[model samples]
Target: MSRRALRGVLGIALLLILWEGVARGFALPSYTLPSVSEILLSVWRQRQLLASAAWFTMAEALAGYAIGCVAGIGIAVLLSLLPPVRRGMMPAMMAINSVPVAAWSPLLLLWLGVGIASKIAAVALAVGFTVFLSALAGLDRVDRRTIGLMRSFGAGPLSILWRLRLPTALPLIASGMRVSTVRSLIVAIVTEMLGAYGGLGWIIYQAVVQIDFVSVWSAILVASALSLAFFGLIGAIERRVVFWR
Candidate 1:
């Protein structure tokens, strides 16, 4: 690893050490905050439980993320092709995004019930706006000079988009995708918290009600790990897709 990567690892290690020290030295009650070691123990002891919940949540998040990306990109492409409609649609998109997706969870749960569908919908809604705005910006942000040169070469709209615009916009879209990875997981969990038959969020809700703080922390740790893994996957794909950048 590079020095920067090493430093990040060291920083996380130090934080975990501090967290453990604070919880143990202060003699904090387990219900208040379990020590990092305790949380780890709980995680290991409850591996099956955590794994099942994490898998369920990951499936929902991935499904929703895929749907959101396709829909967002489709909208962006339509807007880009029909520039005149962009102006009219922009405000409406902004208006919808302004409302936090969590606020829609209750209604989603009521409509979709306490199954995976609600969580999936919540994740999709959370991720869609981000992908849409980023993709739209990417579609619109080509260098004027580069586009002029492409036009000078007699490159048509489709040719320019495939050969130039998309390449130029990939970095921005990748950034958006990276950001949405975490958001998708979070929204799914929060939605699950409201009402879910299974998932990490449901595990958390159960732990909370049972006053199993260690289990709670363990579930959170699992969720965090999943989010980090998802983010890293996106980063890797971004590196591959935008290799020049």
Candidate 2:
């Protein structure tokens, strides 16, 4: 592994060792905090169930992420191209974005019912604003001089967007997308915890009710893995798509 990767692995290892030592030294109860070994064992034993729940959660996260990215980028492009619409819509969008996803979850559950739709909507809502802000800022970062230069060469709004603004905005847009991967999964899981057919969040909820804290941790571990994988996937894609960076 590279130096950075090695350091990260070592840091995580040290943390796990410290965690194990504390749990063993204090003789902590499983309900309070199980040792690393216990959690790992629990994860292994319940891998099948955890895997199924993870798959369900990942599906919701991925679907919502795609929709959010598309909608966010599309809206940013639309507003960038139409200054009048941007002026009119910016305040409304900001007002909506100021609200937390948790605040919207209950209402979404009521409106969409306790299904995958609600989870997807919550994730999308959380992700859309993040991406929209980033993309809009990036799109606006181009110089007025550059835009005028393009216009002088017979470039219309669409042509300027396609040839100049979009390229200049790619880095910020990709950064936003990379950041939103984790948010998408988190929002989906949180919404699922509120109500869901099956997901890591649902598993965690059930485990909590049963006083199975180890299972809860196991589900959490699985969710963390899923989030990391999603984040890595986005990072990889961003690296490829934003090759200039």
Candidate 3:
């Protein structure tokens, strides 16, 4: 493994050690605060359930993320081509985004059903604005001077957009996708906890209600690991996409 990967592993190990020591030293009740080993054992014992729930959550998150990215990019491109439309709609977009997803979860569940639809809608809504705004900003960074030069050279609008704007916006879009990827998982899980079938969030909620402290902690750990893995994957993709930068 690379030094960076080793460092990360070591840091996580240290944190786990600290957690184990604190829980044991404090003589915290296993029901209230189990040691790291207890949580790990719980995770091991419940691996099948955790894996199934994780698969469900991952599917929802990825599906929502894909939908949000496609919609955000398409809309942002249209807005970039029409400055007047962008100006007129920017504030409304901001307002829409300001509405908390948590507040909308119940309504989404009511409107979209308590299944995958509600979870997808919640996750998409949670991530769409960030992706749209970031992509717009990236598209806006296409230099006016470059466009003017292209015009002077008799380059068409389509040519300029394809060659300049698209490339220029790639990094920004990548960054937005990274944010959306993480947001999708968070919103999807939260939505599941609010109203859905099975997911890591639902598992966590169930464990909490059952007062299974170690299981709850294990679910949380799985969630964290999944999020970090997705984020790292996005980062890797970004490096490949923006290698020139």
Candidate with top TM-score is: 2
TM-score of each: 0.95, 0.97, 0.95
Worst 10 residues of 1 by lDDT: 164-173
lDDT of 1 by residue, 166-242 (tens): 77778888898899999999999999889998999999999899988888899999999899899989998998988
**Which parts of model 1 are misplaced by more than 4 Å?**
none
Error of 2 at 114 (Å): 1.1
Query: lDDT of each model, Cα atoms only?
Result: 0.90, 0.92, 0.88
Least lDDT summed over 10 consecutive residues: which range in candidate 3? 121-130
lDDT, residue 62, candidate 3: 87
Please write out the lDDT profile of model 2 over residues 1-245, one tens digit for every residue. Answer: 77977897899899999999999999999999899999999999999999999999999998899899899999999999889999999999999998899999999999999999999899888888999999999999999999999899898999999999999999999999999999998898899889999999999999999999999999988888888788878888998999989
CA error at residue 179 for candidate 3, angstroms: 2.2
Per-residue accuracy of model 3 over 1-245 as CA lDDT, tens digit each: 98998999999999999989999999999887789998889899999999999999999998888888888888999899888998999899888888888899999999999899889888877777778888898999988998999999999877987899989998998899987777888898889898778999899889879988788889888888899999999988898889987
- Against the correct fold, how does model 3 do in TM-score? 0.95
Q: Name the lDDT value of residue 224 in candidate 2.
A: 85
